[model samples]
Target chain A: MKLWEQNIRKVKPYVPGLQPKEDNIIKLNTNENPYPPAPGVERVMEQMKLDKLRLYPDYDSTELVNELAKEKRVDPEQIFIGVGSDDVLGMAFLTYFNSDKPVLFPDITYSFYDVWCELYKIPYERPMLDENFRIVKQDYYKENGGVVIANPNAPTSICESTEFIRDILEHNQDVVVIVDEAYVDFGGASSIDLLKEYDNLLVVQTFSKSRSLAGLRIGYAIGNKELIEALNIVKFSYNSYTMNTASIVLGAEAVRDKEYFQNTVNQIIEQREKTIQELDELGFTCLDSKANFVFATHKSVPAGKIYEELQKKKIYVRYFNKPRINNFLRITIGTEEEMNQLIIALGEIL
Target chain B: MKLWEQNIRKVKPYVPGLQPKEDNIIKLNTNENPYPPAPGVERVMEQMKLDKLRLYPDYDSTELVNELAKEKRVDPEQIFIGVGSDDVLGMAFLTYFNSDKPVLFPDITYSFYDVWCELYKIPYERPMLDENFRIVKQDYYKENGGVVIANPNAPTSICESTEFIRDILEHNQDVVVIVDEAYVDFGGASSIDLLKEYDNLLVVQTFSKSRSLAGLRIGYAIGNKELIEALNIVKFSYNSYTMNTASIVLGAEAVRDKEYFQNTVNQIIEQREKTIQELDELGFTCLDSKANFVFATHKSVPAGKIYEELQKKKIYVRYFNKPRINNFLRITIGTEEEMNQLIIALGEIL
Candidate 1:
């Protein structure tokens, strides 16, 4: 009965984590930063003159690209920015992937990856993880149009080292490989250095996790000049002004202020470790994580029960009701006080 | 040789008119606002109490939609905003136009439409414009999955009246029809009213032209419940954060200050008439325009000569080399002083 393209009808959208309506909840479902962005980020917004907005923003986000180039030691031409890492990944599917070639990703990674492939009408194959919830390198050696894997993988919060990624690139020579490092700043190794060794590797990173500009919606990819140029061409042919003025300038300032940026991320890292310890002592089997969150499930109690109980008490954590992982919960690391509240809630729930 | 989706290989992007590199040119190439955005716009940016850029923005832009609904006198569910009209149109093509049916638009209109069709691999038919450089609405009724037209048509600056659009919507009952009113602010009639009777009509408009938010990257579509919901589902599955915060706030202000917006657009209308008069006096034929820009050709001089010679005198105008309209140039109406400068430059060139 629908008048839309048939493919769009079949696309089941990526469901982002719960955004609570009642603001009183602890609200740790999404892995958002517990701290504000770098102080310079706000200054960029306030100090920005409004007159410039009357003109089109640089299609490439020039200043931010140059800053990313310097920080990542990649050429400015090799960097492409989008609304977020999701947008970048979406573009990758529409531009590089197709109905003919298979898009390859981890079976148990960020759910949005599969959603994007479906939206783009690209045939995709999910490589299953090992029994320990880790990506098996041998699985990705199969032929694919491109390979995408998240580093410091979401939900599990465990990292597949850049070494494994370099080896994947070494083998998948005919295809483009994307390494999403949304949580790299929390301690996972970034594959930024592998750009010279592999021309096909596009390392996707975001300001959302580390730089704390998630609201600003800035994500970038650094790759071989050709692949980057391809993304640029695709952007121009589609929507050129994907990034707004405030988002661009503010993102650059946040990415450049490593001291203030690292201070906030490092705080979250410290909190994550302490929370993992607390959860472990509570008889939860937790993953060794490098992200701003921890993934764990208790031996005797359903994690979903704890999550719902915390929600009743005005504390929130993420619970996936999907099969094979219904008992686990993903808890984002918040400020010291917030984490302490979460721990106290867990104690009370037990 | 390039390793990209085959459909993307032939997408030639629309080259936008040249932008001002320095401050001192009589710039009228792109049809930008002769006036700045509403006073509230700048104030919103200046006083944006965003001490929190670390958190993700409202991906749905809920507050913006709520404000837009109030301004437009429609339900919040009726409006779907995008990064710009480009993003909106691109999403529309992917959602409603792709598949077995051919997407249709005017051959001479928004070149990006064809590019997007190619990007989505959507079979398309660019129905030729009438000799008068206006869209022939009847052409769109011929077995298309969707049809889009720029209502105050670009380059030629002629608008199809509300009655004419209603006629198209009457016959094309099955296919989706999009009326892009990107330049409707000067004098064109909006097709928004037809949304009452037609679930198929999506009237797309932008802040870039009349509202002067080109740099902000914001635009939206007003439609009946079903079409808007379709776009929402497409946006959710693809790029979720379609509009940024500053653009959302500023766009709402632009829509709210109807008097200011009307007065500015009316001034551009007056200036456009005056420019047409002066050009007619100097032996050039100009089209009757409903939009803010003017389209004209001189019998004695080449359009390229006029364009290049004007640039030599620090005046700019758009010159399209497309075979159908190789003799004419599209000039945007600027402030009175800028128009005077343009007049003097044209006089010297003639």
Candidate 2:
């Protein structure tokens, strides 16, 4: 019955965090920024002329790219837009990794990375994270194809230094290295600045995090023009209108409004720190997170039990039953009010 | 260099029509419908909350599918959504056609059909159309792994009767018979009704034409639940967040307002008949078109010369320099005012 490629058969689908329909829960499973996007960001959608929706979206997303180029301090030619960071990552897998060259990513990083590798039928190796659930950058440099690292890594909520990312780029000369900075807006140092020095490097970012455009499915990759061209070629071959017009417009606006962005991100950071502190004080060993989420566990309690018990109190957080982090829960940093609700629920569950 | 597949090297990169910078140029290329979308469509966009732009669009498009199902008189489960008809076609090619069975499409059909075959390394046979540029459905009963036909076929704008399509579906029980109905909303009858009798038939339609939401990228398929399941699997494995929020809302509204759609199509049909009469009298031989476009050429002049001549007057039409069709220009039918301008320009040129 599995007429699909061998890769799809062995694949484990990406499990996005649980979203509860009823509004009473303190939901923080998917690492979505609890802080709402900039008010100015929504203005772009409001301003769209629905009368013009009949025509095809501006093919190149010219204005959005221009905004991105100015925001990233990179050439417009160096940016590739996609539906989401996953779309950009999918483009990276198709464009950069051939069947002969195996792509590489951390075993414990974003689950979609593995799904993409499978879908593309590219061979890949996952270098295991250390006992502390941190990437060994030196380990990735040995005998790898393309390299990908999630900064403020998912499920672990830990960040690898830009210096280490550059080291991987330096070592992997033959293949493209993709750094997914989806959560980087939370606090992680972006490697976007390094695009000037490296042609083989692509830094993938999303407006879903800090810009709060997760609903709109807008993500982009900043790289050398040649690499960006590869993504464009793949995208053109498949879906030309990858990003919706309204989403692209809002993304450009959010990137342009630096003041609004700073204010919201500052609020999220402040909340994340307090949440992590509260969890730590309750005898949980929490990872030092640069993301708006925390991964933590206690020696006395099983992670799944805690996840379920918290759900009983109308509070939800992520619990991955995967290897290397089965005992921990990845909790999104919500607003102060939501975090307080989660903390109180956690205390009760304990 | 084409890195992955040897077949990719053979593909001529796609060049989409350049976007119109000035609004008044009588844009007719790419077969885009000339009129703007319905008034109801605009109302939905204006009413959408800008804050919703940040969140991911509904992946299932449950609401849209329900409305589409209601309109089509089919079960909601039978509806499969994709980015556009092109994306749906790409998925169909990838899913049904693989190593063992090559696809069979008409030689003069949609160009992307062949491109995807090459990209996926799926061997395909392009059966040449008959003397009148009409597809003989009997030709598909050969060794075709699958059959894809663009109804109210592109470039020619010629349509195959529902009876002829049913004959193909009735006989080709072993293969996937795909109807690319990207232009069906304009005039041609849809094969959606045939789904009850044929489990293997997949009919793909887009909101780009009738709904006038090309900028939004919404396409859907109606088929047996089994075939829908196959496409759904491919979709989930690839991009789940394919349909953004704006598209879902706009597409559903566009489908719901069938009366508005009928009015628009009737106007286009009226304009089309007038344009055809005008061209025929002006010593041009045009294909019998059932869709919203006219495929025409003057016996005295080649298509290339006409294309060049029209460019001088700022009139745009699609010309493919391929065999058999090199003499004809695919001119999308415009609004009454737009078509009058085209006629006036043609009168001056003549």
Compare the candidates by lDDT and give the number of the best one.
1
Considering chain A alone, what is the TM-score of candidate 1?
A: 0.96
**Taking the tens digit of each residue's C-alpha lDDT, what string does model 1 give over A1-350?**
64443423456877777666656567788888888888877777878877677777777688899998999887899999999888998887676665366878888888888888777767889888887899999988887778888998877899987789888888787777889899999999999899888877888998888776777888888888888878888888888788887888888888789899878877888888899999888888889999998999999988778878988898878888876678899988888999888888888889
Question: Which tens-of-lDDT digit does each residue in B82-135 have in candidate 2?
Answer: 877777888777777754666788999777887787666678888889999999
TM-score of chain A of 2: 0.95
**What does the lDDT come to for candidate 1?**
0.82
* Alpha-carbon runs more than 4 Å astray in model 1: A2-9, B2-10
lDDT of each: 0.82, 0.80
Model 2: DockQ score:
0.46
For model 1, how does the per-residue alpha-carbon lDDT over B206-238 read when each residue is reduced to its tens digit? 888888778888888888777788888889998
- Structure candidate 1, residue pairs in collision: A212-B54, A215-B57, B83-B217
For candidate 2 chain B, the 10 contiguous residues with the lowest summed lDDT are B2-11
